[model samples]
Target: MNYEGSGHGLARFLAKARQGQGFTVGALGGSVSIGHGLKRGMRYEQSAYSELNMHRIVFDYLDKLFPAKNGRQIGGDNTKRGANRFVNGAVPAIGSDYFAMCFGHHIPEDVDLVLVDMAINDGFSEKGAESYETLLRHLLALPNRPAVINLQVFALMFQTIATGGDIHQGISSYYDVPTVSLRNLLLPIILQNSSYGISYFDHPPGTTELDREGLGTRHISAKGHGLIGRLTNAFIDMRIRDLVTGLYGAELESRLVPETPREQIRALQRFNTYEAIPAIPPKCLSAHSRSPTLIPSTNKGWFKYLIADQPGSIVSFDFVTAGGLVQLSVYRSHNAGLGTAACWVDDMKDKRVIIEARWDDLVSIGYTVTIANDLEDGDHVLTCELLEETKDPQKKHEFRIIAVIR
Candidate 1:
C-alpha cells in the first residue's frame, strides 16, 4: 500500500513492529474501542495491506506455536465468532457486551497476549466482574497462559485515584495480570494544561459547566481532534516500540516512528476558558434548583434508565466543576427536538429542589435533572421530596430517589 503525507507515519510504525517480532493478541472487554485500535495499528505498522493483517498475523503466529492437526477449530468457537468479525471485516464491531458475551467461543488453546477492559460502565455491579473472572480462569487454564494487559476503566478515575493505586494493584495481582493504566499515562498531563496534548475548550459565560450543549456537540473540538490524533499515533508507536524491545534485544536497529512536530499541531489554548470546578464522578446524578426531575426509569441488571415527564420541565447538569457560578438554564428536550421541557423540578423558596410528575398520565417517558454550578462546597441537603401537585394528591406520582450533586 502506497501511503503519502499523514499515512506514511502510520505505515512506518507498523512495519517496524512486525519485522521486529510478532504477537498473538486476544482482546477482551472494550474490544471495539481499545482493542480495535490495537489490531488496526498492528496491521498497519507491520506491512502494506495490513487491515485484516491481524487475522493473518494471529493465524500464522498461533499456527507456528500450537501447530493444529486434524479438523479441529484453531481457537475456541465462541471467542472466534466476534474476534473473527474484527478481522477481514470493513466495519468495526459495536456494543459493550459483544466480547464478554462471546467469551466461550474464540479464546485459543494457546495464546500470547490478552487485553482486558472492564468498568467502562460504572453501573455494572461486582457480580459482572465475578462472571468475567470465571471466564478468564477458564481461558488461563489453557495450554499456554497468555500475558494479560488489563486496561482499568477510565470511568473509575475518582475511585482509583483516591486509593493510591491499591485497587489496580490488587486487581493485577489477583488475576496475575499486567495493568495498562490510563491514569498513569494521564497524571502528568492533568498537572500541566499545556502537557494535556489537547486543549480544554472553555465554554462561554452564563453557560452550564461542561454540559454538552454549552460546549457544543462532539466531545473533542476540531483542534482537540487533531491533537488527539497525533497523541494517539505517538502513544501507539511508543507501545509498539516497548513491545518490540521486549521481544527483540534493544540494540536491534529499527526505525521508530517520530512524533508529529509540536509546531504543526495547532493549539486551541488561546480560546481555553479558565474555570474553577470539580470533575463530576462518571454516571453520577446531579440536580439544580428550577431544573427538571431526574428519575431512574428502568433497571437492567444494575444499569438504570433516567426517566422524566415530557414537554414542560427543563433539566441540566454540571458535568464539570466551576468556581462560584450559579446561573442555571433549563435544557430543551435532548432526545426530543428543541424548545420543549421533558420534566420539572419545583423551586422551594429558592432553597431546596423538588421534582413533580403525573402518576395518572400514561406516556412513553425518560428521566432528567437540573445541574447548577454556583453552590459553595459545604454540607448541603437534597431529598427525594416528592409532591402530589397533580389534579389529585392520590393521583400524583412520587419520585423515590433523588440523586444529589455537590
Candidate 2:
C-alpha cells in the first residue's frame, strides 16, 4: 500500500479545490516527470505530455473536479482565480543535489502540492542523502504547508530504484510525507508479461542515451507515463472521498499527537529563508570565444554548470552576503575526460577546495561540496580555475562549476 501518512496535507489541498479555489502544484524530479522521450505530435511543447505525466494529471484532475464558476474575479481580471497551475520543475539529467539548493528559484513558495520523482538519477552518497533531506525540509517548512509526495519510479536497465531511495524513504518517513512507489505498488504487472508491450515500458531500440550512462537509466514510454498518472489519480480519488465527508481535517485534528514527525523535521530545516544568501546564476567570467563552451545548463532545471577545458581558464563570481558556510554545486563523474577544479574565496588561494571530477562510481551526478566555511560579513570573490594537470590523467582536465551557494 502507498503511504499517505496522516493525509492532512493532501486533505487540506483537496478541501481548497473542492471549494473552487485556485492552487499551485509543483514537481521536482528528473526526466520522467517531464515526459523526456515521449513524442507528442513530434514536438516538445506545453501539450507534449499534458495528458501523460503525473504532474499534469494532478493538474488536470483538479481542473475537472473543480470547474470554474461565474468567471470569478482574480489577478485584477476575471480569470486565474479558480484555475490551478502546475509548475513542472524537472530536468533531464539532474539529481536532488542540484535541486536541493536551487528549488527556491524554480518552485513557488506558495505551492499547495509537490510531487518528487527522484527514484533514479540520484547520487548514492551521504551528500545525496543530506541534499535530498535539505529539499524536503525546505519544502515542508514553506509558509503554504504543501503536501509533499515521494513518487518512486523504476529504472529500466537496472531493474531497481536508486540506492538513494533508502535515504529518501527514511527522510519521507521522518517527515511523514506521502510516498507512492510504482516499483512496490505495481510489481506484478512490471515483472510479468502484461497487456502493455515492451515499448510501453521502455525507450526505442538502438538508443543508448540512458543505456550508456553505466547506470542503465531510460525514459518511460507514453503508455508507461499514463499508468503512472492513473496510479497517482487513484490515491487522489481516495483522498477526495475523505474530503467530501469532512473527514479530511476532523480525523487528522482528532488524532494529532504532541510529538510529531513533521514538526520535528521543521525545526531542522536548511538554507534559512531569512538569511541574506547570494543571488542565483552568477555572471559569467569567461571570454566571448569561450562563452559558447560554458553551457547554460538549464531546461526547466534549477542552475547551470560551466565547463572549463584549458588550463588557466577560470570562472569567477563576486557576491556580497552576511557570510556563513559556502558551498559549490558541480558535476562529478566516474567516466573519463574530467578534470580537477581549484575553488576558493578572494585572495585566499591557499585555502581552496580542489574538486575532483572523476571518482570511483558508475554514474555522473550533480554534487555540492563546501568550498569556504568562514567568511566575514562582506563582499567576496569566488573562483574555480581548471588545473592544467591532475593526479589522474586518465580523466582529462575539464573543471565544471554548477553553482556557488551560501
Best by TM-score: 2
Candidate 1 local lDDT, residue 346: 28
RMSD of each: 18.7, 7.0
lDDT against the true structure, per candidate, is 0.32, 0.63
Whole-model lDDT for model 1 versus the true structure? 0.32
**Candidate 2 residue lDDT tens string, 1-406:** 3577777778777766666666777888877776764663444344334666666776687767875453222111122545666677676556787677666655666788888987677745566676777777677767777888888776655534446665677677777777877667554664574333355555456543334233323666666677677778888888888766777455553353222333342323464545442223222222111122333322221133466667777766775556456777776776657877787888899998888877765556666778887788677777777777764556477656656666
Roughly what TM-score does model 2 have, to 2 decimal places? Answer: 0.77
Candidate 1 residue lDDT tens string, 1-406:
0011222232332343244343344544422222233221344223212322223333343334333232113232233321211212111221122222233233444444454544342113343443344334444434434444444423222223332123334434444444444444544575564334223322233443333332121122223323322443344455455545653335433544332321221121233345322222222232211232333332322122233332222233332233422222222112222221122222433554343333232211222334344555543322222232433333423232223322
lDDT of 2 at 26: 80
